[model samples]
Target: MKTFIASSPHVARVNRVDSIMLQVLLALVPGILAMIWFFGWGLLINILLAATFAVAAECTVILARGRSPLPAIADLSAVVTAVLFAISVPPILPWWMTLLGMLFAIVLVKQLYGGMGYNPFNPAMAAYVFLLVSYPVAMTNWLTPTMLAEHHLSFTESLRIILDGSLPQGLSWDAVTSATPLDEMRGKLDRDLTMDEIRQSPLWGAFGGRGWEWIAGWFLLGGLYLLWKRIITWHIPASLLSSLLVCATLFWAIEPQTHPFPAFHLFSGAAILGAFFIATDPVTACTTTRGQIIFGASIGALVYVIRTWGGYPDAIAFSVLLLNIAAPMIDHYTQPRVFGHGGKRG
Candidate 1:
């Protein structure tokens, strides 16, 4: 009998891409359910449409690349991208727009970069920025939360509005849609309204906006669950939130009348979501622990700056994309020293 030699230090790995992606999908459930509860069936519609489009796009790209499509599709990365894009967009976004964003995410952002692990930017966020720039008006047309709406749209009505751009009788786009909480705050501040006066609006909640705060809370819960399961490390999220809090607190202290509180920053828009899901992408984000902290802190600070002074109301997508470009450099400088090495080498 001949003995065959193999590579040294063989180890069994338990985690798979599909399994990790499945957990991420599970983690999104709390936030998704909360959105549907407050926003209505339009969210569900966008999710279904985006997911379908993403899978189709991924398959098309994989086949064109002369690779087996089923295995790539099975990893569920495209599905995750689709869901993230869906949740980020306005719930009432048109079906065609959703499809277009998914196609951009799956094909141009993901596949064109040589599939999942090769992309430098978060695909969903890149798609979001693309749509936002290309269709600013449509992207900003967020529907009023169900509680705030004068008339709650039924499933069929929401579907019609999304698919056909048809408003129900006696309803107009102005009547149904409103600025997001972040946008409302920016607009109010631009108009020189005091924070207290702005908070008096029904849209304002204990920390962030009424329905939006709770949705962010659910995302936080899901993030914590991921942390508990060891699906993600604490470096990125902790650093991101802490840096954001610090920036918000410093600005708020400087001008309490003009700036919202730190808690408001945490719970408003996509701060929490970006910290956990978008900023923590295994491929695009920094791999070293210290580098992750640096990367996340930069993103957090940029998010605050952009939200306060940049052109956009929510800055997560822009912040993450910017930091994605820096992650490799961050990792290079922050590489950990090898054990028992005599000294650090350049």
Candidate 2:
């Protein structure tokens, strides 16, 4: 064997797009499992339908462009987008809605913009926001955690609901679906209830609503895995979580009765997932070290501000998308110095 010594480290083949996407899917397993544990089979069904439609849409578009779809399909970007969008919506969302979102994600948001690396917006979040805007009722029809659910839906029942968008005669929508934790917090806080009063409901557990906090922990675990694997650097996630924690602590300290504890902010909604997976998207997020910090900080701050006073309960998609639109500007101002240069490009 020939000796191949070099000062620089060798780039591992595992960094290929398909391999990286596979690693991401593997990282999502624990969190996805936890979600299924709490919410039931609807999430799984949603994943399957979204993946199917995403692949189909992507393939159709590639063929329309006079290209073979297999190579692109093997990269698994469409599946990643599908999973992200699927998990963001209600598990009981109708099949047609899933198809629409996938088409918007794969064809419109992604391929139309010149596909994967060339796309400026995160396709998943864009499709999610689109569906949320166009169909708010279906988008927000979240099921309460099974521990606190009035009725535990069977897999067949969940499948039927997603496929047909109907419930059994005796089963009312109000009986099966419940407001998400963020929704609960917003609704109760808007009604002038103290944080303590809101915490007393069976809907709550340690730091957040029942089951949600633990799901955040699992996602955090997955994020750590990604960091350890070197698939992602720590700059974005570290800054994002730190900024969010600081904001949460400051506000909670000022008014404990009105604001939630820092832990609650960290553990509830999509904070953990967004910080690690969504906000750190390679294409849409900042590139330079300083730019990444600023990008993450902005997202974290926006999430808190919007969730507190803006129309949405959770603001990850909105915040990330807004920052995505501004990423080029951020990088322009925060570029690292060149070896012989004293300052960044003007």
User: Who wins the lDDT comparison?
Assistant: 1
- If scored against the real structure, what TM-score would every candidate get? 0.95, 0.95
Which regions of candidate 2 fall more than 4 Å away from where they truly are?
1-12, 343-346
Off by over 4 Å in 1: 1-12, 340-346
TM-score of 2: 0.95
lDDT digits (tens) for residues 24-102 of candidate 1: 9999999999999998899999999999999999998889878899998999998999999999999889999998898
Provide the lDDT at 194 for model 2: 100
lDDT score, candidate 1, position 192? 99
Q: What residue pairs are clashing in model 1? A: none
lDDT of each: 0.93, 0.91
